[model samples]
Target: MVAGVLEVDPAEVTDESGPETIPTWTSLRHLQLVVTLEEVYGLSFAFEEIRDVRSVGALRDVLRAKGTVPA
Candidate 1:
């Protein structure tokens, strides 16, 4: 899911298990990821909220807050 959102290889996300922890995840990738996540989850995020997401886990938390992902 993270790889799809970032338009990167899925293997790139294999080792990622925390918030904003993926080393390859950059600011630009973050934007792309937020957009992709919104589309996939059918939810939107405020700029601040998006900026605040620092890891995959954090992203999951955000989605959970928006009722996009099951907790």
Candidate 2:
């Protein structure tokens, strides 16, 4: 999913993957990504939660903490 959003190889997307780690992960893409995740997971992210997501692992953590992603 991260690879699809970033337009990168799926192998390149891991827990460590993020904007800084992936060159294709532009700000615009990040916005689109957030929207996509929200829609796909049927959840909304708070501003601070979004800001706190620095990696795929972080995103999962945030979503899980918010009860968006299942445990």
Candidate No. with top lDDT: 2
Segments of candidate 1 deviating more than 4 angstroms: 7-21
Candidate 2 accuracy as lDDT: 0.82
* Candidate 2 residue 53 C-alpha distance from true site, Å: 1.3
Q: Lowest summed lDDT over 10 consecutive residues: which window, candidate 1?
A: 14-23
* RMSD list, candidates in order: 3.1, 1.8
Candidate 2 structure quality by residue, lDDT tens digits, 5-71: 8899998988888888899988788878888889888889898877767788888887787687633
What's the lDDT for residue 30 in model 1?
83
Model 2 TM-score? 0.87
Q: lDDT for model 1, please.
A: 0.73
Q: Which ten residues in a row have the lowest lDDT in candidate 2?
A: 62-71
TM-score of each: 0.72, 0.87
**What lDDT is reached at residue 12 by model 2?**
90
Which pairs of residues collide in model 2?
A: none
Q: Using TM-score as the measure, which candidate wins? A: 2
